[model samples]
Target: MGVTGIGGFFFRARDPEALRAWYAEHLGVGSVPYGMWETQAGPCVFSPFPATSDYFAADRPWMLNLRVDDLDDLCARLEEAGIAATRDPEWDMPGVGRFARIHDPEGNPIELWQPEQPA
Candidate 1:
């Protein structure tokens, strides 16, 4: 048997409605208030972190990594929306791809990743 990918990533937000709208406008995510994103992708990554893990660097135990096709384009869009985009060089990999960190209006850290293709 094989494990399936992520079903949904749930996190708290001060205002779910505004956050949903932000994602809809900036990232093109059809998000709903207090609801799972209805997407067509499958076999997503559902990872559990250790209590002492510093990977996410958040007060909370988990982080959401949304895969993207074009990191540069998305970052530009986020900037155009007046959302500050933060980049951590240490989080980037040469072949794996680039990662940009950003927090939502509610202060949820979201990692946007664009993975490299296999050679």
Candidate 2:
């Protein structure tokens, strides 16, 4: 067979431990302390945006997009925790899905996606 799915996504963080904790606490990413996160099987987008694209901030090299379920609920929870999330009706695509934008403590852009469910 061809290559399997992605094993992990590693990125640089100013404070690795704190950033890891923040992700785990807010997004339920790690679940437990410094633990492995299990992700649901779903479509993953691999398209690369143009360098001059305004899809995300210009200063950052990469933006991390996480596929999630229940976009509204997630946004609410983040708001309760003092995290800001921006949602726009225009961002929704008929077959693609809904999208929201947020940032981590260090100002890294994070896009949360809720894929369209099959009818």
Candidate 3:
């Protein structure tokens, strides 16, 4: 029983309050006062990208990938709220999942994944 799951994710924010609000309002993350994000129990990817990986911005050290259930609905909601999200056919893995990319107000890349149905 050494480590359980991810307890928290701390990062530097230029305007912490504003960023927090943006995340809560748009992505429904960290909405609680304790900074505890309620997430579904599913696969959590912990791959560290190479320094030159083009998946996200070079200046950014990390990208946040969250597993979602209804990706198309979520993307539509974001777009209705005036947030731009990009979906590409190339990002879909036959047996893995479909992915969509979006950037927060501060330009942090966020990847939303909808996994394939279990056969």
Candidate 4:
């Protein structure tokens, strides 16, 4: 049988506890060891970019893209919390979705995507 959906995402953190708390507070990403988050069913993109691609920072090996319901409201909340979320008009696709970029405390790139609604 082929693989199913993504079960988990593991990564190293300078301070695991603090980072865990940050994620929980800001993005509602649950922690491990019994803190599994139930995400809504949606399209999940699984693709790799070229090594020389400038879509994200060169120093970071991978960028995390998260599906969101309301990009504008989320970006506003993030800004109110003192986290700067940047958006570029060029990044938007008419039929694909809208996008906003933000960096976590430890400097990890996070892309927030709000997909176009089906008519």
- Every candidate's lDDT: 0.76, 0.90, 0.87, 0.91
Q: Per-residue alpha-carbon lDDT of model 4 for 5-116, expressed as tens digits?
A: 8888888989888887888888888864345799888899988999999999999989999999999999999999999999999999999999999999999999999999
> What value does the lDDT take at residue 33 in candidate 3?
49
Q: Of models 2 and 3, which has the larger TM-score? A: 2
Those runs of model 2 whose alpha carbons end farther than 4 Å from true positions after fitting are: 31-35
Name the regions of candidate 3 deviating beyond 4 angstroms: none
* lDDT for residue 6 in candidate 4, whole number 0-100: 86
Q: For each candidate, give its TM-score against the true structure.
A: 0.79, 0.93, 0.92, 0.94
User: Model 1, stretches more than 4 Å misplaced?
Assistant: 32-43
**What is the C-alpha lDDT profile of model 2 across 4-114, one tens digit per residue?**
787787899898888889999999887445648888988988889899999899999899899999999999999999999999999889999999999999999999999
The candidate with the higher lDDT, 1 or 3, is 3
* Residue-level lDDT tens digits of model 3 in 1-119: 98767777788888888888888887788874445677777777779988989988899999998788899999999999999999999999998999999998889889999999989
